[model samples]
Target: MGFCEVVEGRHSIRAFQERDVEDASLEAILRAARRAPSAGNLQAYRVAVARASSVRRLLAQAALDQGFVAQAPVVLVFLADAAASAVKYGRRGETLYATQDATIACAYAQLAAANAGLGSCWIGAFHEDKVRAALGVEEPLRPVALLPLGYPAEVPRMTPRRSLAEMVLDIREDA
Candidate 1:
């Protein structure tokens, strides 16, 4: 599918099939995430792939009882490694770079999953402290998004979106 088609087809899928996602497909998705642009090339993100039942249970708990997280074949926890970036780029990294890096990477991963014929949902509602504890992240590394992936159980209809003219702003001196 073309880029526009992929974008149009993508949706926040909450229901998934029972089949497991292939490792090759997961690798491709991760590779796409790695290719995402980062601030000063300091890819300040870490993805924790949770598949084990126990881990998924903990993640579901951390995600405010979102059972779909545990039900999905793969739950990718995208984390911002502020301390890692700070170590290389100094204190400015935390405030300016790490969050953007992680968010962009997560978006790329979502697109990659769509291209691979998998379904995904970008989950941002969760307790930070609970997520940190559940994922065992060390200090200064924070969870940014939770992505649950698998074959979609139900085909999703397109959601309405604002027109380009409404969302974009053009301020030309000549105009």
Candidate 2:
């Protein structure tokens, strides 16, 4: 699909069918994430793929009891490696750039899933400490998002967006 179509089609899918996502599609999604731009070309982010039922259940619990997290066929945990970024850019990289990298990668993954006719929800409402423990994610790898991906069981209506006049800002000396 074209870029606009893909973007328009993408939505936060909460209900998923029981079927499993294909391996090739999963690989494509990860590859798309890998291609995301990052600060200093560091790509200081890591993704943990949870396919096992037990782990997904734990992750769901960590994500404020969001049952859809466990219902999806795959749960991808996006993490930021602050230490890795700090190795080159120091404090600023650790505090901001690393997190930005992980967020962008997660966005790319979501688009990829949509383009592949899969559904996904970007989950941010989770207890960080609990998520880390559930996924065995250690130091410097801060959890950014919990992405649950699978085939859709329901079609969600498009949520409203702010108009450009309200959201954008234009500043020029000529004004």
Candidate 3:
């Protein structure tokens, strides 16, 4: 699929098959995330790979009982390395750029998963402290997103989207 098709086809998969995700597929996702653009090229992000059922259970609990999270064959936790960005960009790096870097990387990973015919869901509603504790994340590294990956058991319908007229606003001074 082309980039546009990949973007359009990608959806939040909540139900996953018991089949495990291949190592190669997981590597591709991580690689794509690494290639994601970051502020100052700092790449102020890290990803924690979780494949163990015990770990996924803890993550699911941290995710507030999102059972599907635990069911996925693999979970990739995107973390913001604030200190890494701060060293180069100062306060803004710590407060914003680091988060942007993590978020962009997660987006790239999601796309990569879709391109590989794998299912994934981007989860961000978990308690921060719980996720940190569950993943054994230390200071200066903040969890930004939880991506559960596997073969999808269900294919959700296409969700509604705002039209370009409603979502876009062109700012121009000349008529």
Q: Please give the TM-score that candidate 2 achieves against the real structure.
A: 0.97
lDDT of all predictions: 0.90, 0.95, 0.94
Q: Quote the lDDT for 128 in model 2.
A: 88
Residue range 123-158, candidate 2, lDDT tens digits: 999988888998887887899999999999998778
- Segments of candidate 2 deviating more than 4 angstroms: none
In Å, residue 1's CA in model 1 sits off its true spot by: 1.6
Clashing pairs in 3: none
Candidate 1, which segments miss by more than 4 Å at Cα? none
Candidate 3 runs further than 4 Å off: none
TM-score of every candidate: 0.94, 0.97, 0.97
Could you give candidate 1's per-residue lDDT for residues 80-153 as a string of tens digits?
99976787778778876898899999999999999999999999988888888877887688899999999999
Model 2 worst lDDT run, 10 consecutive residues: 166-175
Give candidate 3's error at residue 62 in angstroms: 0.6
